[model samples]
Target: MTRCDWAENADEVMTHYHDYEWGVPTKDERETFELMTLEMMQAGLSWQTILNKRQNFKAAFADFKVDQVALFDDADVDRLMHDAGIIRNRLKIKDTVYNAQQLVKWHAAGKTMNAYLWAFVDGRPVVNRYQTASEVPAQTALSQQVSKALKKAGFKFMGPTIVQSWLEALGILDDHLAKCTVNHLGKK
Candidate 1:
């Protein structure tokens, strides 16, 4: 069966994610935050690696609840560091907590993380039709702008490359192959 460009292995988890989640536009705050967190965790790594550990990550990060994780203390960091199921990277784990707090801060500023992120795309998904993986961009001007804004908002581990990944995951950019169902170009 055909699938999105990123689902390389075609394993059960990857296939499920590709068909149901990948490139599907999501507006919920919690889901967006979780995808953002996982995308950051995916840095210098494979998506399948992160997908395999997503459950453990949800357990460790309290299901990506910004309210809950923003309150995480040193004890939380120490516990996550030793978790064998997840990536077990100290900096990445720490950034989850930091990013959660930053999300909270942005919330207080009358901005949803979704709102801040979707603003770059002007409140609509940037659909891209690529026949192959090589056609997709690793970074773009949009990602560069979002990366700078995220850093200014006190988020960590959110460079342009990471932001591009987030955009893809959040469906802010619909990077399905040209043949996928949602590939469309409106009157632009």
Candidate 2:
């Protein structure tokens, strides 16, 4: 029952996320897009805050549907800016829409976000064995590569640090502590 130290004193929602969702590989396009947006929204903020407003984000952004969100205009930006339930950062809100548009373009080109992202790790998760949370890096070379590629693909709010966090959340980069029970789960 040993969990990551970070999740030890977290609320029920965060605990559930840590135990069930975090570092769990996902190939679902919509889910991947949602996590990407959440990571971007988490820039300069805490993950707890983003998790607290996840439902609000889902509602505001059409459940992270790429096509739907890609169509969001200035009106939608204004609406999101005024939404009290979610983080009201204008830049993040606008970037979410922009990223959605990029996702749509990728989809139209016969490439899913899931496929494009997983390809970086060669379709497998990179499991890291760390004894402490401090051993985990904030960003890595792989994340920098991915961030550059994403930016070239017209994605917004995808800097290396944010991309690294997104990759970890997506299970592409498994950074669970060695003592954590879920650490072993990342291995095939």
TM-score of each: 0.92, 0.96
What are the lDDT scores of the predictions, listed in order?
A: 0.83, 0.89
Candidate 2, overall lDDT? 0.89
| Number of the top-ranking candidate, with lDDT as the measure | 2
Model 1, residue pairs in steric clash: none
Model 1: per-residue Cα lDDT over 10-83, one tens digit each: 78898777777777778789998899889888988998899999999899889999999999999988988888
- Scored by Cα lDDT, where does model 1 land? 0.83
Query: What digit string (tens of lDDT, one per residue) describes model 2 on residues 1-188?
Result: 88888898889999889988889898888899999989998999899999999999999999998899999999999989999999899999999898888778778889898888899989999999799989899999999999999898888889999999999999999888888876436432
Clashes of 1: 0
Clash count (model 2, backbone only): 0
Segments in model 2 whose C-alpha atoms lie over 4 Å from true places: 183-188
